[model samples]
Target chain A: MTKFEIRGLRADVLIGAEERQEILKGVDLTINSGETHAIMGPNGSGKSTLAYAIAGHPKYEITDGEVLLDGENVLEMSVDERARAGLFLAMQYPVEVPGVSMSNFLRSAVTAVRGEAPKLRAFSKELQQAMGGLSIDPAFAARGVNEGFSGGEKKRHEILQLELLKPKVAILDETDSGLDVDALKVVSEGINRARATGEVGVMLITHYTRILQYVRPDRVHVFAHGQVAESGGPELADVLESEGYERFVKAGASQ
Target chain B: MASPNLGITEHSHGAGEIPISKLDTHGSFDVNDFPVPNGREEEWRFTPLRRLRGLHDGRDIADGVVKVDVQAPAEVSVETVARDDARLGTSFLPTDRVSALAYQAFTEATVVTVPADTTAAEPVFVRITGVRQGDAYGHVLVHVRRHAAATVVLEYSGTAVYADNVEFVVDDGARLDVVSLQDWERDAVQVSHQYTRVGRDARFRSFVVTLGGDLVRLSPKVGYTGPGGDAELHGLYFTGAGQHHEHRSLIDHNVSNTRSRVEYKGALSGEDAHAVWIGDVIIGEGTQGTDSYEHNRNLVLTDGTRVDSVPNLEIFTGEVEGAGHASASGRLDDIHLFYLQSRGIPADEARRLVIRGFFADLINRIEVPELRERIMAEVEEKLALHE
Candidate 1:
């Protein structure tokens, strides 16, 4: 059964401004439970916007489409409601909130998503275990969320949240953008751990296949001009890796 | 300066009546007793002097007796002290100083003293209420005696279009945790002067939260009297529509080896809601090994909101270890708001969280649990007003 389904999705960018343009037009995709799907795209391909739209960002108006999480229309829900509906987005640039401790933010987010307060002792033990598994310093739990953290540290924090919240559908948006080799490995391993739950569906959005080598997506789709241009097995990542989306660009132009 | 009508009315001074003539007085000074030299007056620049034009005109004191509610711990008693008492000192300008004489003349002045070397288990709450017409001048003399540590919360809540002055003296080795809440009626214009003296090795932590009144000015002046004295002044002010909130703080390190830190954060919303933060730190000539820092930050919540921050550091002797100041005035960062909203928190909730987080450092510094909770409630109410 489909865990998330998007039908006839159409999104526009800067509708009233000079850069007014249609980014996602008539796109259709579906992800089943316990499956990892990667979306590879060139620059300006609306990969990030799609992730934001699915996460119900207020700026990204759903002009014409229906995003159903577990067959429930997500467009009708608020951003936080969508989050409570088990939808998680690993941001490209995680915002830094000074004076808001990491533990507090995570606790609030986790309780919000779970719709109930987590037992303190159990939550603390679980959080400590998760931090250790991700190789994150325990001291970071007390520090402000993403404040002055390195790029890798931020990505790891996002994964840590995902593991703790246990969202049904996790959208990884450019999680590998600024990570070093070691960071990429750690982040990919964290994702793998989250995937090991075998109940949550993963939508991995990236431009590079380096991270895919570790997480190993079940399916890979090439996104161009706001729509998925091609789809295949994991080998599709290697083809794009060698050729660098030149063929996809030409094909997108013809279409 | 003494007003002819300066006497205890129906309100009791705890003790019997004391005439104003008995008080130590400062002789007549110029109309501008405190000079604000052209641009050199950092605290005077942002104030709208035009609004203060007729402030000196003597107005009639409110006719009826004003009832002030005092909420204190069971052991700590509170009663109005005589305005002419010498223990309060000559720090505050007498009620007869200009337009506010009438209000200051009638209201009873309250003094809350924590005895020497005695520690109060709970915070003492002093709520001053001004009703009816005329100016109101009430002086609060807090003598946290030697080695005595206590928390006092002074809240100005009333309906009076007048001025109020509060003075506090923290004695040697005494620690005073003061939280002032200003929530007056819309028709009221409040001009409050707060003076604090930190004795040798004494510690004074003050948190001022301003959220009401059409125009409110809070000038908190702190002086380190002896060596090793320290003070921390943290303030949070929120200005809604058609409101003007001004906060000025001065940290005077008179003795050597003293330290002072002042951080004031303000958020202005609505049309023509103006807020100002002026922080000045002066390290005296022989104040060697002194460390002084001041920071003023303002967050404009709307396009029509205006904020002015002036952080001044005057160091005479360069023998100090560190002396610096910082000021920032900016709008609510969209990126920061969006980040919080993305985490399933609604836009309004996110804004409240961000603003609350801005003052969290100062709030956490408050040692009094009851005062902290009350301040948090006030902050929540202020944020809800924006919605």
Candidate 2:
């Protein structure tokens, strides 16, 4: 089992050349392996900021915080180091990388993360199997990574990476936003398959409770004003679904 | 400025409002017809005149012979003829100062011919080595006769200041594939003009790869003599520190139902590394059903490097099928770098992968397998120098 903790995570984003705006303020969270946590928040609630800050995105400056992955200082590691340490961030908007085919990118990623390059025959079989599970076209293996992919196709590719890389802790940021009903089911199934291995922790961040219906979360945290307003079991998600985030926004304003 | 010299008559067509640029009417075979460029003309604006080693001016006249060695299949014919040979300049004329100077200075010319109704089983390799004894002038003519097919590779190496004009004459129903490689020594300077004439229903494909040299300028021009002719020009250049490599291509659609496509990609690294690509496509009046497009893309790998990419499209006829041009030069996309690094690839390896991918689309189009591999290896070597 692996324990990941973020304590007093205060961060700022550079809005201009010399301007900095504080986004995450004194946010705290802990996630353990094999447990899925649903971080529910409205717009500008610092959900994506928290995800990027933990993933070592250069855009976010961690002013005051400590992120510990199994008691190791995760903040000191570089972006690739964070990735090599078994942390993956499924970006809300994955950028298109032209000319680098999906097969080449996946092989490089797997080799870097796993410390050794997999045999070509074995890796091809594994990729074909994973892509089949997600219903992705086999031809995508030769096409440039995420180049000219539709909204739904891009989201599915993100999940495909998640299934192939097999990180210990995955922060899926808005993976189900642009997906259709059928794509959502396929993606959720892939997430569940990763979770079934009992070696990965899922931090599913979303504004809607629709995806929670498919992949049940062990914990639900209502994130507001860069802090957790309330925390509870799976029932909390249903409560938020019915009541909406109006109460949490008002409570955060008052605080 | 010169009244649209090729095909369009001024004020005679409805599309006569477009201004005629001086470059459209510049052509001559006499060295004295063209003035010495002071680096201000449109053709000489991006070039470094001082680095030319007098190839641009008359100081570097041809005094030493640049050895020309031709290797071809037994069926192909190779001949060395005097400057007065009738077939030397039958299909080409000097268009610029350097070309005119080289045309007036060379003592002999090398002509490689593929006879009519025959297909050469192997590519003809013309390897030119600079003697470095004195400035050199050279000329080569590649003739693909009627109903024939051939492939030619022109390889340049060694050190000296050299200027040459190469002509390609493709007859009716013939096809010619040519790859001109400028892999010179570190201190070499070369100015080359390659003019091609395609006959009725003929096809021409040319690849110009510039990888080494202190200063190298190449102008490749193509004109169709009859309808249904097609031409494709593809080029790749990697400019290292203090190196200047430029490619200018002009495609003149003088007849109807002709087609042309030009694509050039470049990468520059190190301080003072400069690359320039100029693509000019003109669809003349009455040349209906003309299809042409040119594109240029440059990848800047380091700071202090410069790239100038200019694409010009001039169409005097509104009846053409299509005509377009595009140019772009910039550093590698940071998001692409981040995307790769976020996947656990190291920063250096990520850069290598992105650069490799940037050139893969063009390199894969090269039909020669060995040359393609060598170009990739050379690209990797340049990337390593940057790192």
Candidate 3:
């Protein structure tokens, strides 16, 4: 099992030569391969920043932190180098690349991570299978990456990348936000399938326990005030879902 | 009262409200008729006058600087004839001064003729190269006979101060595709005008791809001889540091039942890299049932680069089928870069992918794989300079 560790991570948004606001104060977490950890939080809780800082996002300035994947420094790696180091981030809002098609984008990413371009025959077959697995339209292969795509389609596309890139540790940031019932099921099944391989670690971030009903997390983390306020098992999700995060927020505020 | 535009395809024309009336472009082809521009004229406003290299003033006409070579199939005939051969200026007169000077100064004109009803089995290729030559005037004429379908490519390269005139005539029922690539060396200065006439029920299409040159200013005009003519003009260009590339297009729809589409996409990087695109469509009297749409888009890759795009439409009567024009320019999308980098692709390669994707749609229309790959490789080379 590959061990992924975040020790005393802190970062800020480096927007256009100005690092004005800090997001992650100090975050600490660890996940091994074949494990699923869920990072749940309310809006403005800095959950997204945690994901971005760990992935070496340029916009995020990591003031004090260390993101280690199997004892390797991810913060010291470039964005693509971080990915090649077995770290993946499925962003809540996937950007639209106007000219590049989904097939080309996926192939490029696969080549970058694998250090070699995938064979045409194998790539084509694998792409088609992944599209089928994600319940994505076959026509999307030629369409521009996330261009003019609906919210649900974008979420499904993120999962499709997860199924293809096959990173050792995957950080899914709010993957369940905009998906409809059918799309949520399709996307959740995609996540579960990736985990079933037993070689990948899953970190699913969300606000509600809705997607948790489908892809159960082995560990549940309640995030507040830029760090984990509480951590427990799947039962913790039920408690947060039924009773709400009012107590957790108050408890975090008291600290 | 009802809306004039009820068709779903109306949206394809884009949304923006410019005057439905005409804006006259101030200059004519006659050497004496066009007054000397002091950077105040409508056409010369955006162009840097100092960079024109005296081609605008008829000061330099060094003819033998660039070598012209042609490789074509046997079914077609290539000839070098004088100005009064009765074949010159059959389609239209020059619309600008530099082109007129090129017409007046050139002693010999290269004419490639395709016989009527003969579909070409191979493309005609014209290669122009200059070895740091001083200055020159050039002219090219393409005559496609009735019902014939032919493709021609004019490849320009090397160094020179050049002005050129290229004319195309598509006879009745004939189809013509002309691709002009201005892949000049970094110090080349070129000004060119392309005039085309599409005959009854004929089709005309041209791809003007500009990849190099210090300053390249080209204007292409299209006119129809009869009804049912179709014209598609697609162009792509890239501007680097200290380079100025300007392209202007005019499609004339004076007859009934004709269609015209113009689309141009460009990118600019480096400090002071500039690009300009002007699209003008005039639906004159008797032009009923005319469908025309033109769009210009620019991607600014760096901080100091600038792009100016103007899309104009002049509709005479409401009897027209549909007409519209639109233009937009902006910087490289940040979200796009982040998305690609997050997926393990390096930032530099991701940027290239984004740019390559931008031109893939139009480049795919080239039909020939080798040519498409060749042009795209040059584009890749330009991106390497940045990332």
Candidate 4:
């Protein structure tokens, strides 16, 4: 029974060194455990910014906002603090950290969130089981963290983290992009596994409706002009998929 | 492609690249050949000459004293021979002023020999401790006979200003592994040159770890005697505040069917910490099927620290398997930090993990389990100081 809320979130991002561009303007959303919310938008509509802003990325400066998890201020938390506070972001482009083995990174992350390191035997068994569930090769545990991972492999690794970290709120940013049908199915299944736990509030960001076919969303929101322009039940996704975001863009620009 | 590369088609016999390559390096046994460096020469520009404690010049060289202790398996032989012994300089000659000065100053040299066709059951440990009264010089030779295999560990410690030359002669079909640990005291300064000649079908691997010193500089050079020789050079260095560490290596592929690989990693912290790595690989003419690659990486932990990494590759023969060089030096990547922190690792712990991973690759290859753990513990201790 976890509740996450974002009210009037406005954020600006630094373009180079001095120039700042406002990407998110008055974004409002709420997600509860056992519910999946699909964030749909056109290119440059600030969908990714919303995800990063909520995850506490330094690039996204929150000018005016209130993000709370269980009534605890999330926007005030540091990036790691936000994570330890049960917020996770599956980045669109997960960084490749050379020389860091996957086993070590996952263990460190789990220890930080859990406030204590799990027993070695139990942890290894748990890790092998989770990786097996995703059809990932056990050999990858010894390899550098995403050092030479393919696009789909990187996506699968992100889902693997979600399955292990078990955060209260998870934001999957473009997890379906660059994924083939087979990989998309595998990733969708991983998300569904986390969803079945009834403890994770999922915010799925995407530009397509393909992933929604596998993991149905409870609510759909159309984002445009750095804010939500339309919100409706799951049926709204069908209309938007057929009619496209042209009308929402026009309406947002007119506003 | 931007370099003036002499492809095999340009001169099939490798005539165009032979003379120019030979003229680039000037090795001498005479000290006068290399004048006193004024901190302006290409080789001395990055080094703090004044902090060298006169190891670079002839001043109070005999006032210091160094004691040597050797522990070896029963199969190996260790002896102190006069400088005039025939096998003293058979492998290579002095290439710098400090090396030549050490050659002219040392009275006796330690020679460790592994008998032909015998594999030593235990490694040979050469422990060198010195006093910082003035200056000292030393020389050591390790010879692996035909079909023999051996491992040698040279441990340097105590406080002293020292210059020395170390040579390794690997016979045909022999295998040699050497680990040179420079763990001197805070006020110690040392300049050491290591030269190796790999015979036909011989294998040579050397690891240089520099962790403690005021100013430490080491140069390791390898040359092939015949074809089918292989060499691997691995190094790790940690520079703390007010300390300087430099490593220079050269691999000479003069024969055909030769292979060489060099990898060096360093981490620097605190103010005035400096690190320098120079890798030089030369593929000479008439050497076909030569495979070589060298890379240097540095991680700067604190502000006001500096790192200079340079990789030089010269290929005269184009009909080779592969040849490449890479060098990088910078602060810890922000993206790397972000990636770790995004996973819930605290900022300080994330930094420590990244630095540990940076050196783990080289440290894991140390072969000795105890030594590997000790190195990691020492690195962690250093990380704790500034954290």
The candidate scoring highest on lDDT is 4
Residue runs of model 1 more than 4 Å from their true location after superposition: A1-94, A98-157, A167-192, A199-255, B1-45, B48-54, B57-79, B90-108, B344-349, B355-374
True contacts kept of 4: 0.64
Q: Candidate 1 at B6: error in angstroms?
A: 37
- lDDT by residue for model 4 (A1-255), tens: 999999999999877788899988898899999999999989889999998888877677899989999999888888899999999999999988877899999999999999999999999999999998888999999988897899999999999999999999999999999999999999999999999999999999999999999999999999898898889888988998899989977887787
Per-residue accuracy of model 3 over A1-255 as CA lDDT, tens digit each: 899999998888876664368778889999999999999988888999898878876677889978889899888888888888888999888888776888989999999988999999999999999999888889999988998999899999999988888899999999999888888999999999999999999899999899999999999999988989899999999999889888877877788
Best-fitting candidate, scored by TM-score: 4
Candidate 2 residue lDDT tens string, B86-138? 98887776878999998888888999999999999998999999876468988
The digit string of per-residue lDDT tens for model 1 on B269-315 reads 88999998877676766559998899888887778888877676666
For model 4, what TM-score is found for chain B?
A: 0.92
Ranking by TM-score: 4, 2, 3, 1
The CA lDDT at B179 in model 1 is 89
Please list the C-alpha lDDT of all candidates, in the order they appear: 0.76, 0.88, 0.85, 0.88
DockQ, computed on Cα atoms, for candidate 2:
0.49
lDDT of 2 at B83: 98
DockQ of 4: 0.53
| Candidate with better DockQ, 3 vs 4 | 4
Give a tens-digit lDDT track for model 4, residues B2-85: 112334343222334333332255667789898898886667879999998777767744888888999999999999999999
Interface RMSD of 4: 1.3
> Model 3: how far is B129 from its true place, Å?
5.2
Q: Who is ahead in DockQ, 1 or 4?
A: 4
